[model samples]
Target: MEHKIKVAVNGYGVIGKRVADAVEAQEDMELVGVSDVTADYRVASAVAKGIPVYASTDEARQQMRAAGYPLVGGLSDLLGKVDVVVDCTPAGIGAANVDLYRSLGVKSVFQGGEKHSLTGHSFVAHANYKSTLGRDTTRVVSCNTTATVRTLTALQDAELLSKARGVLVRRATDPWESDHSGIMNTVVPEGRIPSHQGPDAQSVVPNLDVVTMAAKGAHTQNHLHFWTVELTRAAEAEEVLAALKAMPRIAFVKRSDGVVAVNSTVELMQDLGRPRGDMYEVAIWEDILTVQGNELFWTYTIDNQAIVTPENIDAIRALAGTVEDGAESIRRTDRALGVRADFTATD
Candidate 1:
């Protein structure tokens, strides 16, 4: 294998920590450093882990260190030092930095909310990694998109099914910082954030059709969302579920008990000992393939932010030719770990 890919994680939030850890776990990738704008407890934690930490300035770094993590310089110095920079900042600000990364000739993988199409491709590590790599930049789909894309990719490729419909009800780890934000004890309608999942999928593999809906809920951890799909073949549900249950990247697939549907994903995360206020556990209910002459409905749970970053790193590896394509990575990683993304559903 090639020398470990040097990776820099740019944002030190929940997703950044997970991404940094995931990078360290990889035999072929190295965590060169971690950076963020503000010095927070998360940054301190990264430093405690022995990863070099840098902020915007020595003074700023000292302030951040007081908050918790030791620091080095500012973001510019950190950016110049790594090969791939995973920008995990919140939506609005991340896009500008992503653009700067591209201009600097450093390949970048961005969190989904930026809603900016800065790169030539969007990636789903297990599904479309090969299609998105080596393109200067790539966007990991939103959490909901990551979950749905994983399922749809398998279905589209395995069963030749087409068309998907989903209703996504989201629970956040914390509320948005806007006073006008409909968070905290409020079930508000934020609608779907503009995303290119449908179009991106079509771009990657034509003849696939999908429609999606989104809602927001109040919580303070990673997002939990659901998807209902319409399949071209109902009888194929069993095979589809079996396939998903066998993928490694997927953490949990619901079991086929009448009382427990895929809706049990959140509870499953709790069982997995996911950190409080974070997304780590996932569950899916392979609901009976309600066949309306071939349309099938099923639901799945996702730890949104967490899903994207690991897969984004995987994408970077593929682009760097450090790993095989997405499908092969799934198969290989499954072999190494002895599990696949698990799937469970009731008939």
Candidate 2:
């Protein structure tokens, strides 16, 4: 039998639970346990799934015990058993846990909320998977950044890109948190020009020339992006679509097919019976993609809650050296996560 990498997920919230599930699905990884500060339904769901639950702190342990939840041990105990820890805690919390991981000699993967200096490497599996192999830590860029890198790199790889500009219509909050968080009646523009996503994506593909602006929407389903790209030279729409199709995890949806809006794509995911209606692929509108001279225009949607899950899985393999070939690791992850090239067609 082959040795599997022991994995512990710290923070069983939005991204953590999904990471745990993805780790469990991988043939080359073992999910030792998960740690969280809360003993709410999220942690309870982990318990129901038979995942070992550990308290992130002494207080959390007591809370879980009082809530009648079973625990294998505390966070340190879980860390001692795992080869790697995926830190899906809120923005700055993961940064605080870095010292503990380093002390235990365990590899760590962080979400994009942390600064690039946290790990010095921001990951997009398709773009920079090889660079992370055997590295101690890495941050999987944010959902929007992941989508940007995935698509832009495809164009870059095909020699079709020169520079790009994008506008992101971000979801106000995760669907589950909409009741208590997010904007209600109005759309709010981000105060910063060239929002952080562009620079974050650049961390993965450093040569990428892109600028982005963003705004918060009244909805919570997913984020929508309108891109105006400058091709290296005049190209046909077919040429651009072919480049995008060459990339893995970049799927296509069409307005003509009634997948006209962000909400429709969410409905499509539920209809497709995806776990939690999660669409991991960046859905591009193929039919509407236009090319005029050296400029290209297109739109796509990002499932902020779920898009980065697969990248985190691939990052684990990269960090553990479990799979040396980035493409092979990606193939394994896409298979395990059920990421497909076409979401609209029955597979």
Candidate 3:
């Protein structure tokens, strides 16, 4: 029998809950428990689902028990029981928890919010999965950086890419926080050249030559990116599309099919019955992809909430040394999560 890797999710917010669920879905992984600092409705939802919940602080333990939510123990208690801890806490908080995880002799995984230097390893399953095997810790690059690496690495693997530039239209905030936070009726630029995403992606695919600029849109839903790439040689649109299609998790949608914008993809995910309407794949507009000699232009949408969930699952397998081949690990994750390479049906 294959050993199921013991896992703990530290943080139960947007990314944390999703990563916890993904871990539970895998046949070769076991979700030991989840730890969070709050006793909010999110924690309640985890309890309702019968997921073991642990408080991260003494105060949180009191607050959770006071609020009638059961607790297993403090964060350290949970960490001691698991082999690896996926720290989904807010950006800086994950960095703060590193010492505790190390003190307990537990492997850890962090989200993109932390610097790559924190773990000295940034992971994108398709790009650098094997490199992370049996490592103590690694940070899964942010959703934008994940998508950037996935797409550009596809081109590079096909031996077609030279360099790339991109513009990201980011959602002002997460959908859940729309009422309390986020900008209204305003589109804000990122205020710098080569937004952090470019360098972040480079951290995973060290040889990638890419630069990015970003702006925050008024609405909160998904992020859209437009890219212009210098290919190694002139390629036809069909060739470029084939390269993208060859990559797993890169799904194609077409304007001709009425999939015209980011909203259309969101609606499509809901119609397809995805949990929380999550589109894990990067949805590229197949009809709009253009090729002019050595230059290629294309666009895609990123589901910030869900895209990295699978990568986190793969990272768990990598860190636990349960899976040796990166491709096999990715295949296992895609199967467990029902990740589809093609969203449309054909005769």
Compute each candidate's TM-score over C-alphas.
0.81, 0.99, 0.98
Q: Which stretches of candidate 1 lie over 4 Å from their true place?
A: 57-59, 65-69, 172-186, 191-206, 219-228, 233-236, 243-248, 255-264, 273-282, 287-289, 331-340, 343-347
lDDT of each: 0.62, 0.93, 0.93
Instruction: Write out the backbone clash pairs for model 2.
Output: none
Tens digits of per-residue lDDT for model 1 on 202-245?
A: 54455667765666677543444444555555555566666665
- The alpha-carbon RMSD values of the candidates against the true structure, listed in the order shown, are 4.3, 0.8, 1.1
Error of 3 at 227 (Å): 0.2
Instruction: Please provide, for model 3 over 232-278, each residue's C-alpha lDDT reduced to its tens digit, 9 standing for 90 to 100.
Output: 99999998988998888899998988999889989989888887888
Off by over 4 Å in 3: none
Candidate 2 lDDT: 0.93
lDDT of 3 at 23: 94
